[model samples]
Each structure stands twice: as C-alpha cells, then as structure tokens.
Target: MQTEKYRGYTLWGHAILQQEGIPQPAKFAGSGTVTRDTKVVEVSGVLDAFDSDEEAELVGLSWCRAWVDSHG
Candidate 1:
C-alpha cells in the first residue's frame, strides 16, 4: 500500500490484483481517511486499469486527491 499524508487527510492506494470473483483485470484502488478532528469519513473505490504496480499506485494517489477534494 502507498500512503500520502496531506493537510487534513491521509490517502492510501493499493494495487488490486486479479482475483477469483472479480471479472475485471487488475487495477488501482484508493481510499481516503480524514485525519482532522471531524467525523470519521472513509472513501474507497477503483481508480483505473493497472499498467504496472508503480503506475497503479500513482493512479490511486490521484484518485485519493480527487476524493479528498470533494468529500473531505
């Protein structure tokens, strides 16, 4: 997992590998958890297709940024 510490939130990204039940190919998944003294809010979802592990991690970071901007 890749983690980024921002001003008011902590973002994490992980590469999803091919799983048994998941039909789609591997992709980047991201989650953001608020770090401030607000109510606990966590958001997670798939970001995009995975080209490489490093690329997937970057995609996840980007997704985390968007999520935090909208939902933080």
Candidate 2:
C-alpha cells in the first residue's frame, strides 16, 4: 500500500496480489480509499491489474485524485 495527502484528504493506493504460486509472473490489482479527517469517503473496486506493484498503486492513486476532484 501507498499513502498520500490530496486537498486535505488522505488517499490510499493498494496493490492486491493475484495468481500466486503459478507458473506465470504474479499480477496485482489496483484499489483505492479516500478519507477526510478520520472518516472514510470512498473505497474503490478493483480498478485494473498491472505487471508491477508500483504501477498498480499508481493507478489507484490516480483514481483517488480524480474522485476527490470530481466530488469535492
């Protein structure tokens, strides 16, 4: 997981591992959370999958930023 502050809101980007113990390389799914103060504002569904944890987390962060901008 990764964290960032955006416009007074706390955003969390998570990379959930998938396809563990397989012949192929592991995959990660992107998800996000948005919070204001100590309250939860939003929790995202699986946004997409990526080749790396960093890429997945980046996607989650982007989703969080867009949600905050559009809803705030």
Candidate 3:
C-alpha cells in the first residue's frame, strides 16, 4: 500500500496479489481510498487488473487523483 496527501485529502493506493488460479498478465488488482481529515471521502473497488504490483499501485493512485480533480 502507498499513501499521499493531495488537496487536503489523503489518498491510499494498493495492489492485490492475484491468486494462483487466476490467469496471467492481470497479476494484480488495483484499488484506492480517499479521505479528508481522517474522514472517508471516497473508496474504489477493484479499478482494474494490472500486469504488476507497481502498475496497479500507480493506477490506483492515479484514479484517486482524478477523482479529486473531477469532484473539485
């Protein structure tokens, strides 16, 4: 998991390891959360399947950033 502060909100990004039984390529699932002053603002379900943990984590963070921009 990774965390950052953006525009007075806290953003959390994570990568979920793919199970052994799952297909290849999409070896990680991306997700994220957004909070303001410890209060939950938004959370994302599995954003998408990614090729790597880093990719998933970045994607999740990007999603959260976009959310903040759009809602602003």
Candidate 4:
C-alpha cells in the first residue's frame, strides 16, 4: 500500500494479488479520507488492473481528486 497527501486529503493505493483460477498479478484498489475539523469523510474504489504499482497509485490519486472535488 502507498499513501499520498493531496489538497488536505489522504489517498492510499492498495495492490492485491489473486491466485485463484485465473491469476491476477496486479489489482488496484484505492481509498481516500479527509478530516474537516471534527468530521471525517472517506471514499474507496477498485480500478482496472495494472502491471505496475505506480500506475495504480496514479489512478488512486485521480480518484481522490475527483472525490474531493465532488464531495468537498
């Protein structure tokens, strides 16, 4: 998992590997959280699979940006 701070929001990227019937080598899951004084808001999502963690982290960042823009 990788975490990044952006625009007062904390964004994190989660990479999972599934070795079931079909192997999923790289799966990207994202979560974002923001604290406003005493309240906290959070969002999470699953993105398309990527070959690298960096790409997944980028998607997580984008999702966090959109979430903040819409929910902030």
* Candidate that would win on lDDT: 2
Highest TM-score model number: 2
In terms of lDDT, the poorest run of 10 residues in model 3 is: 18-27
Which pairs of residues collide in model 3?
Answer: none
Off by over 4 Å in 4: 20-40
**Candidate 4 per-residue C-alpha lDDT over 9-57 given as tens digits, one digit per residue, 9 for 90 to 100:** 6666565543344554644444444444436566565666666766766
Per-residue lDDT of candidate 2, residues 1-59 (tens digit): 99999999999999999986779898999999999998999999999989999999989
Q: Superpose all Cα atoms of candidate 4 onto the true structure and report the RMSD in Å to 1 decimal.
A: 3.2
Worst 10 residues of 1 by lDDT: 27-36
Pairs of colliding residues, candidate 2: none
What is the per-residue lDDT of model 3 for residues 1-72, given as tens digits with 9 covering 90 to 100? 888999988999999998867454458899999999899899899998887898888988999999999997
Across 1-72, the per-residue lDDT of candidate 1 in tens digits comes to 777776577666667664545665554443333344555456455655564777777777677777777765
lDDT-better candidate, 2 vs 4:
2
- Clashes counted in candidate 2 amount to 0
Clashing pairs in 4: none
Task: Point out the worst 10-residue segment of candidate 4 by lDDT.
Answer: 29-38
Give stretches of model 1 more than 4 Å off: 19-40
